[model samples]
Each structure stands twice: as structure tokens, then as C-alpha cells.
Target chain A: MRFPRWLLSDRTGLVLLAVLMIIGIGVPALNLLVPPDHPLHLTAYTVTLLGKYLCYALLAVSIDLVWGYMGILSLGHAAFFTLGGYCFGMYMMRQIGTRGVYGDPVLPDFMVFLNWKDLPWYWHSFDMFWFAALMVMVVPGLLAFIFGWFAFRSRVSGVYLSIITQALTYALMLAFFRNEMGFGGNNGLTDFKDILGYSIHADETRIVLFVLSALALAGGYLACRWLVSTRMGRVLVAIRDSEDRTRFLGYRVEQVKTLVFTFSAMLAGVAGALYVPQVGIINPGEFAPLNSIEAVIWVAVGGRGTLVGAVVGAVLVNYSKSWLTAALPEVWLFALGGLFVAVTLLLPYGLIGLLRRRRETAS
Target chain B: MSELIFEPEAAGMHTPVAPVDATHGILLYLEGVTVSFDGFKAIDNLSLYIGDGELRCIIGPNGAGKTTMMDIITGKTKPDAGRVFFGQTIDLLKLDEPAIARIGIGRKFQKPTVIEPLTVLENLELAMSGAKRLRGLMTTRMSGEERDRISAVLDQVGLNEQAQRLAGVLAHGQKQWLEIGMLLMQEPRLLLVDEPVAGMTPAEMERTAELLKSLAGNHSVVVVEHDMGFVRSIADQVTVLHQGRVLAEGRLDELQVDPLVIEVYLGGEDAHH
Candidate 1:
């Protein structure tokens, strides 16, 4: 079992993987094995919160793939995230069959509430778990493909491309808020009960979800790490540095960008799917442009172009967010803004870059 | 035979074979190509033909449409009127920049444009012919022969020791050579080099002259240079461009003596030398 040089060479990635493995095993053991009264026992609430952070970390990695490597600063990645969430949420809605207040077997409570007698055409196959799982990736991947096809082909890049991406998530947020769109209106999808016949509220189920999120993050990181090691990865950096130079070298720059963009969107989709179950809800609020921008901030704060940095940034910032919002509430947004400004002015390469520079200088 | 059996090119090759039909002697044909920005004509009725394996030096004053000529040939700028063709069959106007490059034309910019963050070897690898598509680029590993080819290019460009170093740390002359090394990796039939000896030391300029001279006959090198002495050293034939069209086409010595070339280009001052 020979591991490739890329995996072994990445010191940060090795540390990240080791830390995840410990948490993956340790969290489940503490939650399931220990009695509630024991000091070592981890509550189910803590597990779910950790699970949510892992999902956010996965989303951050997806943003880093395109934004850092491919030089596509996508401020609309949450559109893909929310779309994946909605896909999974539809399945959960179907699972509620006759258990709702309306007690309708075929129609979801929202459809009945809206006076819709039948399930919409798009929502038909979502009742099956397999179909819903596949749609989670497909919907976001396809949207990214179509959008990137037009955008990259037209050579809309730099700040202009960033602006349109922000516009994309903002537009999705507005559209999903409408009840007419069939995605449960302003409140979005909620009241999820079972996932694959296991009670989502069960402690064991929450533990499984936590472990799965950890696994997904590890897998996504390895996949991205492997990608950047390939010759295509060099082409990505080349495109990022000088797109015209890459073009003159006979590489199809637009196609490369589109394919990578689509792949990144799929990764974001997977993160969102995991997120909905852990959080027990999916709403139009998930599509807010602010969510996408916050994801970018995580990558910038951690270090852009470094995969390990994305995960570390996401977890650290989100943990701080959890604490700050609880402790001071109103000052959380200001702190985030201040942190972003400070990082921009003081640490252009972010925290990881600063550490690497210090280590190099000391040695 | 056993060694040959393991060769990647032998087992379904990926390198693009040059499709340029230069048997008729002329490799590139630009006829009556005219492009304008605002009301002023940048390139007006410009007709130029580059011969097979010919080392042609193009000299002009500022805004003489020298860069614009290279632009039209490379598909960076579409001429508002006229025909641009590679060989006798392939219409260059129909293809885009990457498409033109794939067919066998390579262009170097006025400034050195290497991927600075990448190593010298990686920069050459990116410009190597073949595997431009998604599937090939994603999966194909560099073969042993490909590594040898890169090594040969590194030696040719005098950057073998710097192969592992980031291109960003390279000196100006070294960066220029690296850019040329990238062009050579494509194995292009026609190379459009823009201001190759600009901002180079005397020794570096001489070495560049030697390198460009070595590239001729194997590759049709069209060098657009401003330095007259460098041009005289390397150019067999000189094309003086003035106001978007050819002013004179002859040897450097003859062009130096010609009245029209002296009046429009040499300013009648440098012509005496």
C-alpha cells in the first residue's frame, strides 16, 4: 500500500487528516459509550454542532478549489449549497407521509397548505432516497455548468465575474422565497423526521451523521489534493496567473474553467446535503449572498490556494462565530468585518502563509 | 524491441503531429489584412508572406503596426478585411488563438510571460504539445521520453540548473529564454517572437542571437525587434514596416542603403553607418 508523494508531502494535510480521524472516533465514543452523568460524555447537541461545522468546512474547501486555484472568485456558491439542501429536504418531506398535522399521505403539508392537490412534476421522484441523493449533486453541477459555459466563454472574469456570482446567489434567494416556486416558500423545508428509516433525532443517528461529515471532508480534501498534484493543476495555476498566456499555449481555457467550476459546485452540493440533515432544516435563507461571502472569508483567513487552510479557517472562524454570537450577539457581524479588513491589510496571504513564512525565516 | 514496447508514444501516442503544409514554400500568408481602432487605420492593406524555415526580422517605429501584424496572424485580433491563411488550405481567420497554436503557430509576447509561481520545468510542461483536452490533461502522466525532451529544452535554453527553481526568481534574460523554451515545447512550425532582445545585456543579447539563430531552419522564426545591431547579426532578410505596410524587403545591408528605407525608417541619420 504505497501512498503517492502528494499525500505524504503535504504536512498540513496529514495533520488535518489525523485530527479529523481522532475527532471522528473520539466524538462517537464519548457520545455513545459514556453515560450522560459522566464528565467525559459528549452530548448529542455538541455532536450535531460539530457535524454542522464539518459541513461548512467541506463547503469552504469547495470554494477554495475554484477561488484559490482556478482564480474564479465565486460569491454565489451558497446557491449550489442551498440547492443541494432543497433536494435532500424534498426527500425528507416525502418521508413525512401522513405524519404531518394535515395527515396527507401523498401531499406534503406545504402543498396542502397552498391548496395544491398533487405533488409538482419536479418533486415526483424525490420520494426515493437514491434519486434525491443523485439530484443533490446533479442540480447544482448542472446549474454551474450552464452558468459557467456562458460566462467563461464570453471571457467575463476578475471582478466582473465575482459580481455576477454574487448576483446569481442573490437572485436564487429571491426566487426561492416565493411560494409559487414550490420549494416551501419563505420558511423553506423543515420538520424532517427520518433519514433512511433511522430516526434523525436519535443519538446514534446524530453520531453517524457526524462521522459521515468527517469522512466526506477527508475524502473531499484528498480528491482536491490529488487534483492539484496533477498536470491539470499546473494548468489551473497557469490560468490563474495569466489567462492569456495559458490561451496562447494552446490550452482550452474556458473548458478547463467550466469543468473545474462544475466539479467545485458538486462538492458544495454534497456539503449542503449533509448540512440539512444535521441542522434539521433547509431554508431560502441558506441562499443568502452573505453565506457565500462568509465562506470566501474563511478561505482568505485560513489561506487561499491551500486546501488544509480552508478546513482550518472554516472550523476556527465558525467556532469563534458560535462563541461571539452567543456572548455579544450584535457585535458578531462587526467582528467578522473587522477580521476580514485586518486580514486584507495585514496578512495578504492569510494566517497559514504567515506561519509558513515564520518557519522558513527561523530555519 | 522490448524497450520500444514500453514506450508511451508507441502505445497510442498523445503528442500532436504538426499539420502545417509548407511544401509550397510559403508557411504563412497574410493578404490585404486591415484592422482599425477608432477612425485611424492601425493596419491598412498589409500584405506579408513568411517563407518556410525563414528567419525574417521586422523593424518599425512606434505605432507602425508591428505588434498588430503578429496579433492578426495569431488570431488575437481579427482583421476587419482580408485573408489570413496557414499553409494553402487552412484559413487562419476561421480559427481562434488556441486553435491557431494547436495547428503549429506559437507567439511570444513583448514582455516575459512565464507562470512565475510554477517551477521552470512545470512551466515548460504546461506549454508542451498534446493533452490540451480535459481528459488527457487530468489523467496522463509525463512519460520518460517526455522528461528527456524537457531536459533537452532546459539545456537548449541554458536553464538546466534552474529547472527546479520558480520562474519568478529568474533574471530578465533567463525569463526571456524560459519563454522561448515554453514556445519550443509546443514544437511549433512558425514562431512569432516579439522584441526578443529588448532590455537584455550585451552578452545576453549575443546569446539570444545565437539561440534564435539555432532555432532557424528547424522552426520558421519571425523576430520583431527594435535593436538594429541585433537584427543585422541574426537577420538574413529584413522587412521594414512603416504605417501598417511593408516599406522595404531585402537584406539588412541593402535596406540600410535604400533611400526609401533610410528616409522612412533609418531617419537618414543612422543610414550612413
Candidate 2:
């Protein structure tokens, strides 16, 4: 396939690969090879923190694939991310196997506490890491396909689609928070012991997960780049610019939309799965509508349509979020709001666009 | 000067048809097409016919349902009651917009709706005749001959000079030409062009008239135009629409001098104007 060559030929794509490579190698070295007492030593907390950031970057790239390229503003993307997290959380719960606080081979602590005699049928096969991994991608991908089928076929678009997506995630949030839903309710599946019998607390495992997150980000970027450069990509942009015109041109606009929407959801699921292992928790809080809104800001701050810009935006905004929440605490959301307003007014294309402008002027 | 009449045999040499409509010799047949928006009948019991490889012009005042008629034929608007057939075999009313378009029916919007961000060449590439299925586009690349075809269309439209420019930045006349060029890419059996010269300079209008006239013998062209001079220049037969029905259908000279058409459209006081 010409897909690899197609991506490497672009300057933005090459720069993305180089940056990911640096982060992938440098972070692991700093965390493992360097002495722990050294001032520049990367701590285990920092590794997990950056791992989580990489996962967030992957999520942002997925959003940019649809929103920037196809003009689909999905406000409920966090639902897919959380569902993927929950899928893997189920696996982690199954892996606990008699080591839980309840010490039941067949049930996790939540099931035991709920007085269930046997593992719920839905929870079966999660004990195998491979099946759980498959579900991580499959579950979210299926939901997005079904949602897009109903929405696009009904000709629902623009702000109405966004509103419906928000309602969907909100509904899922309520459903998952109930004690009877069989998920952990308020405190979701957490305290995961080991994955594939590898210690979750090990620094080596953290490094591997961090590097894997970085790889996923790079892979996601390449895939999106390849997709947009193809004729299929041109059709997608045509749909975004003039949907009726596209339809009249003989392209099935709804099918095009559903395919991309489903693909993007799968990418988010993979990101979420990686996230659970690093954060050591999966909870209903991840389904919060505010989280999805915050993701849009990341794409906006970085650049909406450009895949690389989405990654840049996610890292920069989240870093600011972490720093502000530590220092001023209550000022983060306002800062995010202010940043969005400033980006909209001044740099409508985000930081990547800003760089391109500077380069154009300089040249 | 001697009068010249186009012999029917000369017209079919460059004809493009998926399957020749030899039996009917009629490219499009519509009967009793009625559509209403919010209880205001935009198209009321409309019936029309277009012959194979014929260049027909439809002229009407604003709100006379010229566009609505085109919409019904192209399946953009589903008539409450109507029968629409293409080439005597295809049931047009049963198909959707894209399906109708795919089966060799192309319609140009009143406003130029090119993908603004894409280059003029890219716009033509998207409109070019080929596999429109997602799988086909994903697996295929444009062949060398396809590039040559795009170049030919650009030259024909006099847009060769601006082929590299963004469609968004094209001037009003240029955008209109580009849209026409786009429609030509599909090689549709029946081309529905709405207000082709609405915003054109006179020079552009002349070129557009020439372009439409040249396309007639190979492709059946239906022009919904307000410019009488353009219609008179290219129209083999002119159909006058008034209040969602055909007011008159004949040669331009016949319709221009009709007493009833004059009373409704061309005024008695402004007869010579």
C-alpha cells in the first residue's frame, strides 16, 4: 500500500513521527535508567501522568479525524472512551480472581457485595485478556455505528447531532451509576491488581504502557493522515463543505459519515483501554459531559482539522490543566474558557495554524 | 444567407447513452408531478417531456416552478403524486437524488456549490465519472487518462488558466463555468442546468451559450434560464412554465408571439421591449 509513503511525504506528518519517537524513547530512559534521587529523574507518577497524556493525545486525534475533516462535532465521544475503559476494567476485575476483598474466584468484590451467586453472563470471557481487548474496540465501535445509523439516516445533522450525542453520553452516565447496572456504580471498577499476570505497580510496566501509548498516538495519526489523503478523504471534505452537492454528485454521504464515525470511536476505545492500565481506575466520572466538552477545547486549541494540531492542543491544554489545578485549583475551568475564547478570536486555526502563518510570513 | 437545419443523423455521432432509448426517442417523461411546501403548491400538476439528445430551454418568472420541476425529475423533491421515467425503462420517481445522479442524470444548482477548499482540478476530479462507491475510491487512484480528461474539460470551460486555484476564490463567472465543467464530468444523458448565466458578464454569457449549444447533440440538455437571449440562441424548442404548469411548448418564435404567453409573462405594453 502507498499509505506509508503517502504519510511520510508530508512535513507535518514527518514532524509528528519524530516528536513521538523522541518522547517514546526519552521518557522511558529517564524513568528507568536514570538514578531515582537525581534532580532530572522521571518519577513513576510522572510516567503515569505522561502516559495518560499520550492517551489523551490519541483521543484528541480521533476527534480531529471526524470533527476537523468531516465537520462532525461529536459531543459524546467520552462515552466511547469510558466504555472502552469499562471493558478492560471488567477484565481487570476478572483477573483479581479470589484475591479481591471478598476472595471469590467467580466474582469481583462488587458482585460479591451485591450478593450474586455466579458471575453475570455478560461478564463471561472477560477473564481472557484477548477477548477483553477485542471488546474494548468492538463495544464502542458498535454503539457508534448504531447511533450514526439512526442519526445520519434520519438526516439529523449539525447542532442537533451534537445535542443528541450529549444526551446519549449523559444517559449512559446515569445508567452506569446505578447499583443495579452490575458495574461498580459510583466507584467504578478499580484497584486492578495485574494485567496478563504482570505487576501493574512495576515501573517497567509503566514504561511499557507509556511507550505503547506513544505508539498508539503515532499510529492513529498515520491512519488519519492516510485516510484524508485518499480519494475517500476528498469525498469526506466535499461532504463537509457542501453535503447536498456531494449527494447530488452520487456519493452516499450517510455511509461515508457512519464509516468515519465508527472508526473514530474505535480509536478512542483503544486510547481509553491504554488509559485504564496507567491510571489504575475506571469510573463513571469519565462519562461526565464536561469531559467531552473539554476534549473539543483541546482540538480547538491545537487546531481542529489538522491531526498533529489536535495532539499538540491536547498536551498543551491538559498540561495547563494539571498545573493550574495544582496552583490555583479553582481557576482551571475559567482558564480553559479563556483560552478557548482567545484561540477563537486571535488564532482561529490553533497553534499549528499559527506556526504555519509565521512560516509563511518568514519565507 | 441560407438557413441551416441540424440533421438528426449528425446529432447521434457523439451521443452518450448508457443504453440507447431507441424505442421511445424520449429521454425524460413526467406526468402530473405535484409538490407543495407548507400548503403553497410550488409545482401543481406539472407534466413535461424531453426528447433524446435534445437541447430544451425552460423559461419562467420567479416562483413559476422551473427549479421545482427540475427538482422533481432529479429526485431532490418527491412529488405527492407523479410519474417520472427516464429512457422509458428507469422509474426516476422511485430513486433518490444520488441514485438518480448515478444513473446518468446530473443537475447544476442555481448557486455554484463547489467544494471551496479543494482546488479547481480537485473539484473536477471528484465529479469525474468512475466508481463512486467508498470501496472503489479507497482502492483506486486516478489513471493517466483521467488526468487528461480533467485537462480537456478545463480547457473546454476556458478554466485551464485557473485550474490550480481554489474553487472558493473563482470569480462569479468562473465558478459558474467550473460548475458546468463539473456536470460535464459525469457525461450524464440528461443535464439539468438552473440559471446558468444568472450572474455572468455578457462575454461569459456568450461563451456559456456556445458551451450549452455544443453539448446538445451528444447529451440532452435542459436549461432553466431567465436570460431570453441565451435561451433563444441555444434552445431548439422552448417550454414556457407558469403557475406550476406548462404554459406553452414550441419553437422560440412560436412562444414569443403567443397571445396568452404575452398576457401572463411578456407584457402587452412592453411587447417590443
Best by TM-score: 1
Model 2 misplaced regions, further than 4 Å:
A1-5, B1-22, B268-273
In order, the first chain's TM-score in every candidate is 0.99, 0.98
**TM-score per candidate:** 0.96, 0.95
Q: Highest lDDT among the candidates is held by which one? A: 1
- Tell me which residue pairs clash in candidate 1: none
lDDT of 2 by residue, A5-112 (tens): 576577987888998999899988998888999988999999999999989999999999999999999999999999999999999999998899989987999888
**In lDDT terms, how accurate is model 2?**
0.87
Model 2's CAPRI class? Answer: acceptable
Candidate 1 regions with alpha-carbon error over 4 angstroms: B1-18, B268-273
Tens digits of lDDT, candidate 1, A1-363:
997787889898999999999999999999999999999999999999999999999999999999899999999998999899899999999999999979999888898999998788999999999999999999999899889889998999999999999999999999999999998999999998899899999999999999999999999999998899889899899999999999899877877788789889999999999999999999999999899999999999999999888998899999999999999999999999998998889887788889899999999
lDDT of each: 0.90, 0.87
Instruction: Score residue B122 of candidate 2 by CA lDDT.
Output: 86
Q: Write model 1 residue lDDT over B1-273, tens digit each, in one string.
A: 223312444322234454778889999999998999997899999898999999999998878899999998998999999999888888999988888888889999999999999999999999988756555566537888889999999999999999999999999999999999999998898999999888999999999999999999998999999889999999998998889988889999998888888787787443322
Query: CAPRI verdict on model 1?
Result: acceptable
